[model samples]
Target: MSAARGGLVATLAAVLLVTGAGCGGPDEPGGGTITLPPLPSTERTTAAAPAAAVYRLSGNLCEKADQTPFADLYPREDAKRLVATEKLCMTRRTSAEKSVSLTIDADLLPTEAAAKLFVETGRRLAKRPFTDVDGAGADAYWDGDQDDVKLTSYHGNLVLEVRAAVNVKDGMPDDVVQRLVRVAEGTYAKLAP
Candidate 1:
């Protein structure tokens, strides 16, 4: 072959070699021309799905609840109300002097998914003014309107609702809000822990 033709052939061979090397497969950024082999069946072809976290609460809602937080606030009188549809219980405490009452409702649902959805919906539907609560459960909010204030919390599969009602005619304490916050934190520690 002539010298010019030989030079062109050499350049073409070099380009073909580079292109072939690039076509081996893509794990490279821009991708590759050839398909990769399938991963072994015993080995995970792709990342396995993560397991759902297990959170469970068992037994009586009333008997197992912690109410010592209310010892200073009211006279302890616990209650249990089981409807055909759900498990509901309350610990009602009354302030002897101010005609104040606080009720803690621990409602256990069938699954964590349901309780989470309930709390999510409840938080969205809240129209009254409320404070966002942390460390109580998966999510919680405290709201007060007129004579009644409520703290709704969700943990595991349990939906906890704490309601406080005071008689405005009788009197209201200045530190009631702070005290309720303390009471809520104390109550959640016992229940969730």
Candidate 2:
């Protein structure tokens, strides 16, 4: 072929290649610069579904009760309606040994009753001396002290109490206590009323 003709063909080929890349032509596998559906708004706008509120109460000793009233332990205004209640307790081999108990209450609607019960029970148990034992697991007790107790109420609504140091060999099984707590909490969450 003539030199002029060959040069013309080369120039045309280069132009075509540049045009194809710019336009994301068929030559490109998945087209060009694919833009994602405008990245989800990072702005802290309101959530589509609001998350449920969670509350934690700890280090509440009986001694502090004198300074802080039972009503203050769980403020009425913060209390949410009762969603459910869970009770857990541990038993000892003999009747003489002390038992420990724990309770957790959940609130669905949120109410003052839930908060009152939680604080009242906590104060009542803390004021009483609770014995501590070695092999009790989460809720163990000894003969010397009354027994260890823990109560947890959720959203200031549900109330759960754990009572330990009961007769284990003949009385309720340990597993039953856990099941009761779980069932009660779930039931309260459902809010039958």
Candidate 3:
């Protein structure tokens, strides 16, 4: 494996470890409060809505990839390779020539505060500086370097993220990144308030 890919994998692993560590035992002191860094925002979000009225996953998240819009954005080889869970939809492509993966996460939080905290924490954990993503969502940012791009957005009580990982020899394309962000944003909009 390339040094860059190895380093990226390690960095991502560290991020996951740190994020996972946020959880604590039921009796742990002050563990109920998720320890997240403050977001660089001054405005406050509105009060929480009823759980039934709030943003929640709808339909099959992975099925969106089968649509023409999504199919046209990705390589034909990756067209039908989506695997989705309650909170994530992922597509992977691997051939003798190249290998790449795209994953979209629909982060469902207990409250709007938790969602904002999650998004901000992800931005802080990026290996590279994050650039604000305009026209995507509220306080969106593109994290990670050129080889992989992690587009994150804050919408309602959801922190949507789309991560694209490509081989170092063939860096991720700008168009691909934009299209993936658009897809994620569209999906988020469709599923949330």
Candidate 4:
């Protein structure tokens, strides 16, 4: 396939993998059971309270991501797409004419209860297929195809979605994608008690 065609296919797959309006809500479009791990003990503190509003920022959401992995991929100066209150952070790094890109979306909830509901909704989404990922967070799943990686994780009062697409013709590496997921999960885990 041409590079452009491959990139388009990869982008579509990433969109589908990261579906649910960035909420990863239960309304996943594909039909498959999503087995989610149990919420963390720290997340249960506010289970009895009413759900709080989901947090959405208007600035650079990528700033919340783990910088270690992305630091080299997207340099600070070149990756500074936006540094404001935007909820979506998308950027690409290019070298020798090859480029790799990523998009990160984080929804911070006002309460743990709200976070749980947000995550549970994604778990219940009968259409989206997700495999329960162990040792990642309170609940987590890794969704991917031939071209992209999308990891959805929830912990404490945070729900995070990490998506990456490398040079489409060359394809993205599994380890690279896993590292991004780790970054997303670890970053959110720190927010908990």
For each candidate, C-alpha RMSD in Å? Answer: 18.7, 24.2, 14.7, 15.2
**lDDT of candidate 4 over 23-132, digit per residue (tens):** 64344543434333333343454368644334444434555556456555445434465332445667665555455566777777787678778877875652446666
lDDT of 1 by residue, 1-193 (tens): 4555755766677677667867643443223333333323423424595543344455655555555555675654534333211233444455556445666666667677888898768765666645666655666767776678877777666777767676777554555555555655665565653
Question: Would you list the C-alpha lDDT of every candidate in the order shown?
Answer: 0.59, 0.33, 0.65, 0.61
Per residue, candidate 3 scores C-alpha lDDT tens digits across 1-193 of 5555755766777676668767754454333344343332222223453443257776566654322333443444566756767677787755555666878777778777777888777755555655666766666777677677777876767777887788889666667557656766677656755
| Per-residue lDDT over 82-135 for candidate 2, one digit per residue giving the tens place of the 0 to 100 score | 222222212222223232222232323255455555544443345443333222
Per-prediction TM-score, please?
Answer: 0.54, 0.26, 0.60, 0.58
Candidate 3 has a TM-score of 0.60
- Reference-based TM-score, model 4: 0.58
Q: Which residue runs of candidate 3 sit more than 4 Å off their true CA positions? A: 1-53, 65-70, 73-82, 93-99
Clash tally, candidates in order: 0, 32, 0, 10
Candidate 1, residue 170: how far the Cα is off, in Å: 3.8
Question: After best superposition, candidate 2 residue 59: deviation in angstroms?
Answer: 35
Pairs that clash in candidate 1: none
Lowest lDDT 10-residue stretch of candidate 4? 30-39
